[model samples]
Target: MAELAHIIPASTNGPRATEGADLTESERADPTNILVLCPTCHTMIDKGYSQYPAGELRRWKERSRRARAVAFGTPQFTSRAEARAAVEPLLGANRTVFQLYGPLDDVFDDTRADQWGRHVVDTVIPNNRTLLQLLQSNRDLLTDGEKATVDIFAIHMKQLEERHLEGNWTPGSMRFPDAMNVILKGDG
Candidate 1:
């Protein structure tokens, strides 16, 4: 199920805080884009959140190849724990997009963002396209809302697939921009 504000962007800085600061198109969008994800569906959309049209996913692959220069592991969320710490306690009455096998609390690990990242990718990639096909072929069988969800998920899955094809993988890292902003005790 979609967790409210769970798949959020990587920043908390309001616009004025970063005024005139250099930012990539991606970084600026990080904090705002984080979406609530279900345990089963989180795996697929780990790389990025913006689900683009088909033509873009294909084009991005070509661009990514050129941008990739050295051997680098996938980026792990440096701020995973901090983000979770901040978000979890406040999720007292957030919405869920889908069903879970157990308590939501049981499905998460606040300290380890890497595992969380993987789970997101795994949930969205498999059968994403296949599901689209099923929906298209059986449109008559679906309610209007079901059909809409199918359409949205299909876009997300396709975007993730493109990122995958373009080698948009990351390994564990201590200081990624998208990581949680942990304020260690006694530091401030």
Candidate 2:
């Protein structure tokens, strides 16, 4: 179901061949140097149609390895609680964003509104971006149920950024509290 292509090409005449030269043939063939992609994606990459270059491909492969480790690595959890506890830190990063969300006032002038604008712009949005990366980069760590939760949160964060966080958002028009309640409270 997966196509394993060399991160550094097996052919010595290829672009990254020198880099792989130091590696033994077996090392060059090692799973670490390989990328598992769908057949169509594999063809695109192999045919040099992908936008990603060698370095980017390598980084993606490394992240995949890390994700796989998260899914299957040592210090195995003995219970659902233990597994949830392990990923709590990743999910908790959004706590400040949730706290700041409710204080946003779209139709009133108040200190909370001021705080909301500053906090959402200066902190929440940036934190959400990082949280997205954390969730995506370590996706394999979560169970199917947990992955669903994380994915929904990510979608909400992206939507919030696009809707209210980007650019000079009008003060009386951005009702983040109502708009992002689903994300903030995980109610949906």
Candidate 3:
């Protein structure tokens, strides 16, 4: 599991605690100063602070941020058609996975349930996140209704992530917005 590791140790009472002594309190608490590392990596970095200095850790964080931006960044599209083109592939992928292994009535068997869980984690969740990013970034192409649909979709996405990633099951979470299918298409 991923653990939040402070780039410059959060506390000053334990191992490598003194590492962030130079940073202000706000900087120490900042998201930029945290690394989402696996438990083993977190332990290694915490125990070997000299080997993983604050500057080096900060560089790693920055590199990761840049890499994610390149991999998932949405480009500006001039028209609704262009935005639709950019969004369709991810939507199709998500639909395919949902059709094959989603929590449908016919897929209630144990094996299918297992596959559904795995696909939700490995495919559905990531696709939804990327789709959300694309829609939000290309909001200029959306109609008023599409924007409203997106706001609801955002809630569904958050609950889905929390249910799967954070293991926080919330009842009565909003369903996927069907209107999202035509987002940035036709009229509002």
Candidate 4:
């Protein structure tokens, strides 16, 4: 599992103990000053602060960010067909998972709930995130109505993630938008 480690320790007496007297609260809390490391690496860094200084940790963080951006950055397309091609696989995966394990009016049970939670984390959430990024990147191809639908879908995505990840069940969370079915298709 990954854990967030501060490049500069949050407290003066934290791992890499130093009085960050010159840094503002926001700077200390900034995402740039954080590193997502495995438990082993986190412990190694914390215990060997002299060997891995703040500047070195910041370099590692920047390298990680750049690598992720290169690997997963959203691609912009000039046409709807290209956008659809990019998004279709993720949509189909999400749909198949939902059909197989999603809550139903009278079919939900403990087993189905367990399957649903697993699929939501393993498949649905990632697909939703990628779908949203693709749609947002290809927004130029969408009509005003389609754009509105995308806006609602974004809100629905957030609520869904919050419900699963943070255990914050929000009543009346928006349902998935039907228009998403034809988002990058000519019909939309």
Q: Each model's TM-score, in the order given?
A: 0.26, 0.40, 0.59, 0.61
How well is each residue in 1-188 modelled by candidate 1, as lDDT tens digits?
Answer: 45433233235443222331455557545644333446554554433334532234335544444334212422212243432333333221111211221124455645344443444345534434433443454455445554565566555555556554555544431211111112211212
Which 10 successive residues of model 3 have the least lDDT summed?
8-17
Best by lDDT: 4
| lDDT per model vs. reference | 0.38, 0.60, 0.80, 0.83
Q: Rank the candidates by TM-score, best first.
A: 4, 3, 2, 1
Top TM-score hit: 4
Query: Model 2 misses residue 12 by how many Å?
Result: 27
Question: Between prediction 1 and prediction 3, which has the larger lDDT?
Answer: 3
How displaced is residue 76 in candidate 1, in Å? 40
Q: Given candidate 4, what's the lDDT at residue 55?
A: 78
Off by over 4 Å in 2: 1-93, 104-109, 167-188
